[model samples]
Target: MTGMRILAVAGGYPGWRAQALRALAAGWPPDAVTWTESDALPASAAGQMTLDYAPAPPAQTCAVAEPAAPVPAAPVRISRDFAALLQHAALYRSTQRWALLYRALWRWQNGDRSVASAADHDGARLHAMAKAVRRARHDMIAYVRFQQRAGGGMPEYLAWYEPGHDVLASAAEHFARRMGKSSWWIGTPHGSALWDGQAMHLSGLPADPAAMPATADQVEPLWLAYYQSIFNPARLNEAALVQHMPVRFWKGLPEGPLIPAMIAQARAGARRVGQAAAVGEMPGKPVPMEAGRAQPPRALPSTLDQCRRCELWRHATQAVPGCGPQGARIMLVGEQPGDQEDLAGQPFIGPAGQVLDDALRRAELARETVYLTNAVKHFKWVARGKRRMHKTPGQREVEACAAWLEEEIARVKPRVIVALGATALRAVLRRAAALQDHLDAPVLRGDALVMATYHPSYALRVQGVRTPAQVAAHIAETLARARQLAEATLPA
Candidate 1:
């Protein structure tokens, strides 16, 4: 048999294309007629094999010409690393383009053209490879451990991580620059890079060395205990847990050893909550009541100026009591006190309230005619060095202060109540729905119409985003709808 002629093809560069050419050469005899970029062959044989090369234009582009000879399939193996490369490649290209790259790679690797060219196999292969790469990369990042290196001054701690793609490098660099004042190193398998307060230094992948804090105070055990104790078994999603907290992350997690135990404890904790709910010991259990009888607080205070039922009272500069006429037509419920509200002991005096006031004005509603108070009386916040950041009240926190909310509702007796978000919705309606879905929906609580809408803070945050104008419009629309609904429901 005449030695089958073989031609090596590469995109560009010598050393970089060496592996691909050598791989092709291995499948064919060396004497099959070697041809370099300059080598010219007989016209008859040259016409049979075609290598299309277009003039290098200033603008980047690739064009493929027709081949006279059928290209033999090149054999290639799909390893886990290759799958990772495919995933990174996908992020830079469109889905269709990624599909093409995978198809090209797979067809070249698999010798059988029929198998590689099959539509079903090609599509499935591409999808499988892409998924594998994404998952592998996520695992690598989620689990990779870093050590605190010596000789790096100023940066309190240092760690290393290898990323699958360059996509996260910028984010990592940004985090390192902001979070670390001293030197820090992030190592990838491809290379390692270090950021000293002033400059970035590059190095090869570091040797794997066991790392531990110099101090004897390892917090993993205690942290693991607390984490395990808090684990909710009912929310145990093995797939989600693995996806989010992959095994790779275990080594870095202080409480990594306790995950299985924590998972078990979480299940037990869920059972306990269920049992407590069954026996009426659960926190925030809805109090059953007789119809028409307002469940007022057993003891009513003359002035809500001072009430300390929770820790929120300690930090929230002051308690903002309910305000307005006793029989106001509308009652507006808010989440909690803002920094200014906490200080002034008033609900609508803060930036958030100002925004709400503007919306109310735009909607042709009188802010003075509406009774205003928060579902939560106390301010819950985290103190950053000096500034206090408002924190969302948990169900337990909300219910702990429900006595005040009930007292306010009983005293005011507003005809229409507006629930601001999940927090206020829970207080008013005793149920919570997706806030976005029920934005303009009127929830009926007895005869009063309860409308749920995005909180003013939500609108304020949305204002800075891509859909700022749309979000602002939605806020106006929803508020206007609430006033319209309030008017229709209130008897003339």
Candidate 2:
């Protein structure tokens, strides 16, 4: 241990520090190397290596009459996934994080190829620490509320945050990208980041929280008023609200204090609405059908529009019903409608639908020959500015809408059903199951052959990692397999 060399770094620069790790691993034994980013190094350290933040000097090569045989470089292999994890874990506050990452990397470089598995203790520890760092970065980005200076020169904004990890440097990039051409400063317990319209600078020393303004801004009241208006009395989930926006962040947020009062008002308003409904004096237009009552049979799409089985109907414009031949051999069930589908009152009409259409064409399956429907009838969404972003429906909501789906299934009587995503898979199976488990494989559920496949929307979400053509190929393959299964189940 006394013979080992120590490498001192300025912490938070994982990429530069990684170069040192690679150099050490290629030169010395793992046990004979010590990496430190602390303020002071051990007194007994035999040798020292300092990692400079600035660009390094170009290497100078000198000719030697008898060049010593180059020491064989130790085999060091790191996967892109593991490298990303190590970079994230470097921001963790744990003192042993550097050692842990090195040990994992060493094991990976050695014969142990399973070093990246979560089942391995070191790998699991690294993942957990990386997860914490990632969460802290997310929290910093979400909770850091910038307040404008009273008498601003070039319009400066300031915010004070207390992140659980060393994430100020990592999270600063997000603010820089989001608030382009605007100057802002975010101070944390560990450090501070300053953005000046053009560039971002990170200071290693902690900034005094007192420097931030404590007074409320003029826009806060308007924000609170808007929050109150949008706070749905019908859906009051305090536990969920607190989980997403933790109590620890309440101090920094402007609408924090108003939450309690808003919840109270929401409860009271819900009670009033309940009382009004009980007396048949509803707040809005009365729903044609009673809540939770079994819907009556009507062989028309207009009747499905009058459904009130779930709260989804209250928010969505209309119920998006299945379309195609009534007795088609194949039925494709998607999770739910999107903004386009909700507006059009039809299934598979959004960007996801376009992808599905392309895949169907590639699979040689005629669009008119197959039935298209959704597991859930209505489009569930949360408003973001003017956009209605899609929201996954809860299991309870899925169950509530199951009756309509069952009606469609009975009407269609398709020999083969394709569940397009986890939500649709759960709906069709009547039990929770992973999409990967049944993909491209048919499972006979009584008389119908049910197959699972990635949803078109999922392909859209993963398009950055996987090309659109690749995703379409996968969807096409799944559909082709489903068509073959359908034909096999048909009467010979």
Q: Indicate the TM-score of model 2.
A: 0.48
Task: Find the candidate with the highest lDDT and give its number.
Answer: 2
My TM-score estimates for the predictions, one after another, are 0.38, 0.48
- Model 1 C-alpha lDDT per residue in residues 220-281, reported as the tens digit of each score: 33444346435556557878988777676575556677787766765666556545544663
Report the alpha-carbon TM-score of model 1 versus the true structure.
Answer: 0.38
Residue-by-residue lDDT tens digits, candidate 2, 1-492: 223444455655454355455444344444545567657566644334322222332323111112232323655557899888878888888667767777776676656767687788988888898888898889988889988865676438888889999888878999899999999888887788999999888898879977755445766755664565456655678899988989899988888888877679767777566455456633666568775574555443347765666689778777788999988989999999998777667789789999999999988999999999999998899999999999999998898778888888888898999999899999998998988888866787767889888889887777466776676788899898878877874543
RMSD of each: 20.5, 23.2
Query: How many backbone clashes does every candidate have?
Result: 8, 0
